[model samples]
Target: MYDYVKGQVTRITPEYIALEVQNIGYQLFTPNPYAFRVNEQIQLVYVHMHVREDAHTLYGFTSLEQRELFRKLIQVSGIGPKGALAILASGAPTHVIQAIEMEDEAFLVKFPGVGKKTARQMILDLKGKLGTLMDVVELPSTEDELPLFGMNPYGHELEEAMLALIALGYSEKELAKVKPQLEEDEALTTTDAYMKQALKVLLKMK
Candidate 1:
């Protein structure tokens, strides 16, 4: 029933965000919750309201394309809201689209709860149906090249950036190669700054 919510981010967790709009806090589960900051002003999230017999849940996304992809994923028989969320959690929807278009069952199976049968089912259901979203599909050059979700500001910036990068599907091996450059950058002071610089370094490595 809800298309989107515009408000301030009052709280953020690894899995969800509490967005306060007009004196009410609406909990929204997003693919990249850490990408948001606590108390951020005037954030807009495209949302999906999932109603089940036992509960009603809100899934949110930063962009329209992300929300649209989530909707399509859940329409597949074997993929539920949680499973779809796991697929989107990688912060790289482009790769998902690419896998579907290429009929890459092995790549699709990497997401949690997706098996050989489910992967094939996804391809069967969505392969040629994905529309305009295809125009925006740009795969990450390297795993770390996926966009950086912002990190906690209270802790060590570099440490938080590393955690966010890891959550975005970057391997420890890739991170180790760039950690020194990030640490040695004397001008970088905030998690956002570190995240941006780290993304630049990672993209350069690609």
Candidate 2:
């Protein structure tokens, strides 16, 4: 029922964002909730409203490109919204588009929930359709990497994060570029936090 909301970002939790639009707060679940800034202006969030027997949910994206990709992803036989979100969470839409186009089932299945059958189905279903969205895909490269961890960080945390990214389907080259940016932060610990940070970095690059 909603197209988009232009408002101030009042809150950001790990899973969702609260935007105050015209004195109302809209809770929006995104692929990565960290992508928004508190008090920043947002525009044109293409949305998907999911209604279940017990509840109603609204998911939002900054751009129609991401929403379109999300829509196509969930249409696959074995993929669901959560699974599709995880796939989108990786922040490398171009690689995903490429994987679909190239029929790279091996590569596509590396995401958190994707399997060989689902990957093949993604290719069969969305290969040619995602071409225009290729421009929106952002694979992090060396020169244009985003900051991952906090300032003055340790190498181990970044390394572990890289491992997690690899486990999440990022390539060595892509991880290498972002590693320095992540290493700059000293406060982070454990692979999970690193995974979160890594995803944030990857998404920003996108």
Model 2 Cα lDDT, one tens digit per residue, 94-202: 5677667667676676577777878878888887777678776554543442322133323433454576567569999877777776665444533446677777888
Question: Where is the poorest 10-residue window by lDDT in model 2?
Answer: 145-154
Predicted structure 2: lDDT: 0.69
Candidate 1: C-alpha RMSD to true structure equals 10.4
Model 2 alpha-carbon drift over 4 Å, by segment: 40-43, 131-192, 195-206
Write down the lDDT of every candidate, Cα atoms only: 0.79, 0.69
Span of ten consecutive residues with least summed lDDT in model 1: 145-154
Error in Å for residue 88 of model 1:
0.4
Q: How much is 52 displaced in model 1, in angstroms?
A: 1.2
User: How many backbone clashes can be found in candidate 1?
Assistant: 0
